[model samples]
Target: MSTVTVTARGVTPDDVRAVARGTARVVVDDDARDAMATSRAIVDRIEADGRPVYGVSTGFGALANTQIAPERRSELQHALIRSHAAGVGAPMPREVVRAMLLLRVRSLALGRSGVRPEVAQSLVDLLNADITPWVPEHGSLGASGDLAPLAHCALVLMGEGWVRSPSGSRTDGGQALAAAGLKPLALAAKEGLALINGTDGMLGMLLLALHDAAHLFTMADVTTALAIEAMLGSDRPFQPELHAIRPHPGQALAAANVHRLLQGSAVMDSHRDDALHAVQDAYSMRCAAQVAGAARDTRDFAAQIAERELRAVVDNPVVLPDGRVESTGNFHGAPLGFAADFLAIAAAEVGAIAERRVDRLLDVTRSRGLPPFLSPDAGVNSGLMIAQYTAAGIVAENRRLASPASVDSLPTSGMQEDHVSMGWAAAVKLRRVLDNLTSILAVELLAGVRGLQLRAPLVPSPAGQAAIAAVGGTPGPDVYLAPAMEHARAVVTSPELRTQIENAVGPLS
Candidate 1:
């Protein structure tokens, strides 16, 4: 029921999350309205003078040289929306649609897009009323402002497309608007181009993906702590004195978390002097900080890029305060594309390392004293043996998904828009990669928790105990593995593990 008053500045990732979840209403501030009015005057001047403005008076893209009379200008705007709303395949997730709407509104509210204040207000109204457009999954080239996907969203503004109700049921946009006590907006000069010409689609997904990544990175630390306890690995390698010599901030942070999580672990204490074991643990067990730390640093870099994008004005032919409308290449998505691709590479490596830990925990030879596959009777129960396989499968898939989509450019729009960024494709795949990483972490938690269970009377640290409790008790012989894995996945993906551990220990980095 609460609302977020959006200004020309100060929108954050958290704001996007709240609005996308339908828990917050958006209202434009007076300053943004004033700014928008200023831009609208410029557009009005261009319209009256019949100036050869890029989107205001002439056709778009390859047809830019063509001019139209004042009478058909309205038709030009309508035709532009109809033609560009060419997205196909399954409708995008409702949250993504909502985010697209919000970001588009934000971009226009920057007052550079030359739209009437009412046009932005209508989008805010649709969001407040919970009428989300049914945007499709494909059609953007990540250049020309996420054209096709955003066009689908703009279609609903004019009441010419479909939308989803608050209950997530599909309905006609016209019907939804009528029921919500609203009317369809008629497009004016430069409004159609204003709606579709931005990087909102790719940027919105990256914002959500970054939000999820923040939690996943913390979970990575929690699960890594559990893996170390289960493997009876030494924490000596994580010493602050050692990390200070070759300080990567992320590595040092990850090491500090491991040290804190294993502070008073009796399991680690029990093996501290066990000369029977090797002097050092395997790389997956000891080098978790190094690997996961590198991933964290890469994610931080991506977050920096997302923050910059949040502050940018992404439209083309932006209206200037000096009363000139000029075309520019701000619509190209190269920055977002590179960030998404780089983050995917980081996510894939984190999953790959976590899967290796799972394999080590389940292998009898590698696991030291644990029973084969961590099953009470290895022969009778497959006992998460195939869980490791599933993790491996997803990890391999992530490797393929991590192949940067941004590098593969194709020509479009009569080759007028060549060498596109493919940023939208990169962002879409990054989301999938993050999802796979969650599952991979869950698989590791499943086996790692069981390993700790077998460790028995020798208890883990408070943090490790919290993670073990979150994953629940180890399974008995020959039970259904899928449900247990799913439960573990739910625990791992949720904040339960982190909350319990943070409450027990001071807090994790």
Candidate 2:
């Protein structure tokens, strides 16, 4: 693994990706000490003047007007963390939790949020030392900036939540803090608000979703080519002229990618006019350029939003360089929340469309001369008949989860959080959509590869055949349908196949 010093201003999306993949580590920059000092002095000025700050000297949410005596302010901060640590659901994946830590660390390092140097360093120490909190997957509104989820993050700094050590699970934060030899941070000034009030959940979810979408967009194109050839469809629709007229970047790219994948192949070239007898291929094939293109466009747009959110200071009562502070809605999740919903919609469509193509591959009427249900002895052996059913089941679930959570908001926090973007729901559903798309595409990959093999000696383009060869040569004719589905799911989800294909063809742009 490589180590990278992460000053708030210097972190990039690539840096976050490296952290997510576990190929890199993060540390506060040497200059951050000065930033921390600036933060501390700012807090002093706020204290000297006795300013009323949101989530600082006052209470939170509906209780924002409630004041705490200075003597109890420190206790107030700790109590806030402990009280808001109310996440409930299955624990988030280790990668997601780690990404949250990284986001919090980056936000603090920006030096815009009014958190003390100790608070920022504690975040750094927790991440660098791997003292991550086991946060739950749900319980966030994506407004007031993922309050509950982030509070648990702050709790880990206080040494009270569940954490994993080399040995086993430990609920005692003190023991884990001592074992790691890390000290608890004194939440000076606006530290609690700085800790909990941010869009880290939405940010983390957006980054991971966008990253996966970019990879999967490439996979979708390649998989579609396999499906096209397997179905004996015409390649004319992929001609550059159609995409050139409309000139959508993602559409043109999809068309170009399909053409490249189909280059130098007997299956495609020999059957160049093969579908002349039919009016046009189904939407799955005919509209592949458009559907896949839309998804690609959305993914790119979402990536932009993720980059912006990652660099931003998302805390309330933002601390300035001179210790003057201001309350603001920087904690609102509207920005990334919208993108999260968009991402879920696109990903669900990706799966929804792939499911249609898989249906075409399995259907008795539409599947060319192949055996019904993809089995030679259709009556005796079910073959992939039920696999298609399972794919349908998954696609249905994706559709159900695809509803835009950002559009629907319910008030909480005594209506103070009215119009809360359910962006958290969007994140959760996008995750499900990603998983469903992988499975849906996997089933199609299996069926398409089988569809390709059944055509024997009529192999696809060099790129296509090479991909086939790389997927462990071709399986035997009697291979069980279950394993093929499993294999296809693995290939689509694994970055290896996607990366290899891109390497073979070079950059799209």
Candidate 3:
């Protein structure tokens, strides 16, 4: 069953990854439910006690002093969602909407958002039913809390905007609610603000990015292992005892993994392996453990931030239990904006190194006895020549994108949001980096697979051949790389790929 647990405590990055992978359900604890009710009471008390609050009884943003008549408060709340739903352009991807809904519910679940239990449940219901909001792909400053995109998210709950269904079709809010046999929520005070005022958009993208980045981080090891065998490097470098000399956890883990990939390999045999025929190997081939290890460290570092942000409440003018609403800057995206850029930097570096390895594979000089471009018919076929170009293009694009998005900030809301996080830009760029890195790995995989085939009859290390079968090879020769690459991508995301890779390289048998 799909489930997510919300306690007063925090949600971890691993939890977000689990939800993204479709392995769990989302639920709020009784404590959280009770706390939310108390919070609503607090806000109500503050109102009755006649204390001026930021958003509860007052107007928002530039209109803060413009008193909202009691009769117009609900109208204002509903108007806020409808007006903010002014997001333009194509709807956000279904996966992103899932991430958004997950983050929003988690944020509310912290019991700080002063949301009614029913309001929170409505969000949970949407997620469980796979009801994706028609959030536009653009419009957000990462300040004032991802307003536009989030407003669209809230709109679906009120039965206003369109919603994309689980069956891969789009329908009107009313139609979708009817089809699903659900009723539109009649939102109460502070509910719309809670829904639209949070950092869910930027947070959602980061959650998804972190999840995918973790997957690719592991896969990078698989390709690097293949490259290790293709280069026929010394297994001595990966010896567990040798790595214990320095003992960086990442280094040790990588060494152990490569060791597993090289286990019982005829290719690593000094007397039997062709590697001994050469004097030395390329840096990329020899330094695989060090390079990818650092990337893993980066991933671990960023994971810490994402984990904390995943469940924390992040919205303004939070309604409290004593009916006392408080305004604060928890909605600021700076924390996550920095994380997104940092994750992107890590992703770019990994891709850059993979590109280097790909380059070495193509360089006749660096290729160490392999024909130019890993092709026997080098000049006429160009072999993996253009494949390198594609990889190069991807790396170059990431390099440009790696410029820290969080570093650039501009004000909006008439200076109400002066110190922006630029988080949306960071999340989007990181996602782009993820896409490029996948293609680069695919190119590397293709070259490695072909190189092993050329050394066929001799056979690769048992580890290498098994992994090859696990990937199932790209389609036939004429499919052109882009489609083949997309197919390779789908395969990698499958449970079969990871299981196969693990099985093939397990204990290097």
Candidate 4:
């Protein structure tokens, strides 16, 4: 049980992933607590002075003009959480909900959102207890800081919403808290607004997607190298000299990875100087590094945006050092929306190109003398023929998902929140695209490894041999294609396989 300290400086993408996917504990640092106290003094001053500050003494969006009496202010905060917990769909994954809790704690711990230190600690308590609030998948428009999703989380803190207990059973929020030896929080002035007003949901999903994409992208490069050797294609196109002249950073890195992976390969050496054997390979084989490189660039660009968002204070009516509370539009999620949408397009392109390589590996004419479908018995076994179809179907779906959700906006809150960001939608779609890309690469690995085995005496490179050993499914008269395909997919997604490959051949880009 490792612990991640949340400070005013904020946490990293890795920190988010740890708390989200692993059993890591969270702690708010002392400096962040002190800062929260300093900010709380300002909020208290506003309340005592009887000034109508937005979110502090007044109403929320589309209702900001209506002022509430001091006696009714606590009720106002309670009403906000109850009204906004309006999400309706299947409950979100536990990891995603855990991430939202960690991120909201980070936002409040930053000290910009005027909240008592206890408010932030309550979220940490929920996380430490492994109590996940039941957040529906379809509430946030990704504007006003993923309001609906965060509201569901806030409701749990107040012991008034549904939650999944540590034992994985659905239970009332109050019972869950009591079972974990924790107490529910009482909302104060501006506390409810502070709890829900942040881009934690979409941002959490983006970070997780980026984490998975990093592994998948490297696997893509590895599979492309295997495909080249399996197809008896020329590796000349991956020369550093060729990539250096054009000098796209990602292009250079991708080319170098493939070049390194193909070192000391008997298959590539067999037809090195035979001009008639392969004067030119097809676009999928020849331009693999180029397509994967472009996707790498896109992933890096999205990472930059995510890093900046991680350090942001994404709430309205932020407390300033000058003892003033100013309302700002920092809650809008446009930046996160664009980044998720861009990454979706990149993932789709990578998967689409890999699908093409899978098709080539199965075709007798294009596979350079390999048997049709790589079947051990030509007519008796269909081999991995249907696997290619599965890959193609997923690629088609990914193309549709790549359509930018950020570009489509439906106004809400009586048009007070005109032009919502829809970042949550974009992030959700990106997750699907990444999953499809992983499956697509698995199909290629299955075909490519079979092709390598078909070449017999002409062995693949060291890294390629490691990949073959990792996905040890012998090419023969097909025996239950579904299980073999699943095994290949599991190998494709495993970190152990990537570690094995990198150990054999240095490190991939």
Candidate 5:
């Protein structure tokens, strides 16, 4: 198993993925422990002095002005977790829950959240033990630090919620902790609030999305190249000189990738100087780089925002190095919200364009000289006709999902959080959009490869042949289209196939 050492310094996206999706153990190092101890000392001072710290001494949100007696302060913290653990909807994916746990530990380990070393260590134990709390999907407004979702996690730490054990058995949190030889955490002043007060949930989803988008966008470039060849489209548009004049970094990279993939292609060579071919290919074939590149640029922008968030201390009443606890609005998730929404829009456009290419590959009028739907017998067998319909349906769904969730908000916590970021919604919807985009690209690959097979006597480039082998599917009378489509999707997502393609064409951007 891989190991990720947590320190006061924030973690990278790869660190999050390792612990979330891979068998990685987590260790909170001494620097983080020391930082947490120093911050805990400040919290102790505030509690000993009985100062009216917002989260330390008083009620929360609209009740901040109300003071609690010292004897009931611990009760206050426990009650905060119980009340805020009111998330609804189905349980989140284990990977998402794990990511949330890891990011929460990262925030607390930074020591600004005023959590004790043990508090952060408890989360580390959960990650290392593979104990994932049952966090629900629909609770965060993307403001107030993913309150409900994080509270569910906090509830697990207190041994009061549900969790999936290392053996994948669903059990009570206390039982799971005891079985792992770990004890439930006792509430301390500001500890519960600290545990639940960060943008960890949404940020985790954003990081995971960014990671997957990197692969999906690269595959988009590969599929675009295949579609260009299958449709007998000109590769001149991908020339570096044409892209150089425009000079968008993503556009140049995308153009270069397609250009490399299509090198030495007999299909492109056959149509290179043929006046019999159409004067210009359709926009979907000719402008593939521009659309996919724009999405790549957008994905990069979202990544920049996620990287900054990874290093941020996103909590209320953060402990300052100057020996003071100050309340701030750093927990607002507008940055992540805007970035997630923007990336969804970009991904949707990529899927939309790919769907167009799929349609073209199935259309006899547009697919150069390929048969209708690439079927051996046009009317006797409907080859990939309905495949285009699937792509179209997903594209339409993606269009609706592309509507920005960040722009919508509702007041929560007695209007204390009057303007919510709705970033959690944006992140969730972005996941769906990416899933839809993957399927759409798979359909395009399915059709594009079949179209290439139909042009058998005129072979494709070496890279194209490698991709066809990677996404293997019989191009004859449509037998069972569903399984073939699923196989194509599996191939699209397989890292091994991506590696094989790179071996043939050099690395894609």
Candidate 6:
């Protein structure tokens, strides 16, 4: 596997994708090790001074006032891990667990978390060996740094939890480590807190979501262009001069992408001077760039936030350079929570508008000469009718998912941890929104292809032809529909369709 080295500035979304997808391993930098050692030395000094260092010497949450003796401090770390590994429900996907491991390791590698260098190295070893801990889908309040899910991850390093082996078999953590020719490290003071404290889980999900949005939004533009040409709509709204007056960067980029995709289309030129083409297209087609561009702008903001979180040192009782180990609220998930919530709203809106386009394509009156539902024999076969229904249901679900989780506060930890971020919930829902959107866009693209094929002698642009060709398979009399829809969604999400379009159209924003 390829390896990505971690520095204090942290990893990028691409790095997270590589590690999560199991294509790469992470290596801590030498400077990070030096910093870790420096922080460890400070922790040692604080221990010698007999000061109550929150997680280092005293109890956690409501029990912070209760101090522990040095002899039992290591035990405290182990106990913290065992107790906080209380996540429930279905196990998270391997990729997400792997991302959490990578992010936690990166944060610890920064050396501010007061962990021994060996602890950081152990996380790296686990990731390199491809042993993923079984992290559950629930139990994080998006505060205290994804506590339960991360604790589940930390437990594997101590050889005290179940793990998925490199061979994709389930086994005990100890057995996995033994098979990999490694041994589990004993937890030291503040090590457990370091392991579980960060925005890694939410951040990981956000990174993956951000990556998905970039592709889907681009695909949205491609699919929208196809729909516009198939419906005989004008591309005049996307002129750069018209966009310059309003000057939203994302709007301009999206408009340019659609306008480029529609270039050299005989179908568009056929009606360029036709005075009777309903004056202008509906909001779904005419304003696609505006809605999609706004989503792009929202995505830009979320990306900025994710980048900021990547560089953050999120552990409590962080070790300072001047030998001071002090507790802080760096672990709060509010920033990430808000970003996730905002992106979900954007994804939902994108899907909502895409569904509208699909509805317009299927309507007999609105679809121009195209047969109802894009079916050759409209009365005998209901082509892609229920497909729009499927898209509609998912879009509705996305609407519900878009409701911000950050605004809802639930007191936990005996009210010691009040005003929880619910950021993890926001991330979870955003993922669902994105998944739904993929299917929604797929439906729209499939409808556009069917409509374009029906246009027959009137051909679409080279980019449109490339999109149709990448999706393959001709539109036919009613067939088992799932496979085509699945193929369309896959092609839309992957680079195959985008690459095909860009090859024909030069480049897209």
Most accurate candidate by lDDT: 4
User: For residues 352-420, could you state the per-residue lDDT of candidate 1 as single tens digits?
Assistant: 989998998888888888888888887878788899999999999999999999999999888788779
The stretch of ten residues in a row with the least summed lDDT in candidate 1 is 467-476
Write one digit per residue (lDDT tens) for candidate 3, span 327-406: 88888788888888887887887788877887876677766566677777755566778888988998999999989989
Residue range 1-509, candidate 6, lDDT tens digits: 78889876677778899999857978988888888888888888889989888999999998989999999999999999999999888778888888888898889877798888889899989888888898878999988979999998888889888886556566798888888898988998988889998889999999999998998999999889888888888899899998999999999999999999999988888888877877878999989989999999999999999998888899887988877788889899999999999999998999999999989889989987788999988778999999999999999999999999999989988889887899899999998899999999999899988888888888889987887787776666898999999999898888888887888788898
Instruction: Return the lDDT, model 2, position 487.
Output: 68
**Model 5 RMSD in angstroms:** 1.2
lDDT of 4 at 57: 87
Report the Cα lDDT for residue 344, model 2. 81
Candidate 5: global Cα-lDDT?
0.89
Candidate 4, lDDT over the whole model:
0.90
The number of clashing residue pairs in model 1 is 0
For model 2, how does the per-residue alpha-carbon lDDT over 1-509 read when each residue is reduced to its tens digit?
Answer: 78767785747777776776574767788676567667767777776778777776888888999988788788888888888889887777666777777787788888887666677678767767777686877789877888888898888787678775545454666667878888777676567878888887778877887878887777888878887787777777989998999988999998888877766677766655654546788888989989889888888888888888877888887877755678888888887878888888888888788878878877778977667766666776766777888889998898888788888888888887787877777887787788788888877777777667767778666556655755553533355667667766778888777566667766543
| Candidate rank order under lDDT | 4, 5, 6, 1, 2, 3
User: Across residues 80-171, which tens digit of lDDT does each residue of candidate 4 receive?
Assistant: 99999999988888999999999998988889888999999999999998889989899999889899999999998998899975566667
Off by over 4 Å in 2: 165-170, 273-276, 470-480, 499-509
Model with the higher lDDT, candidate 3 or 6: 6
In model 2, state the lDDT of residue 238.
88
The TM-score values for the models, in the order shown, are: 0.98, 0.94, 0.90, 0.98, 0.98, 0.98
| Model 5 alpha-carbon drift over 4 Å, by segment | 165-170
Off by over 4 Å in 6: 165-169
On residues 255-333, what C-alpha lDDT tens digit does candidate 5 reach at each position? 9988988898899899878879888889998898999889889999999999999999999989999889999999999
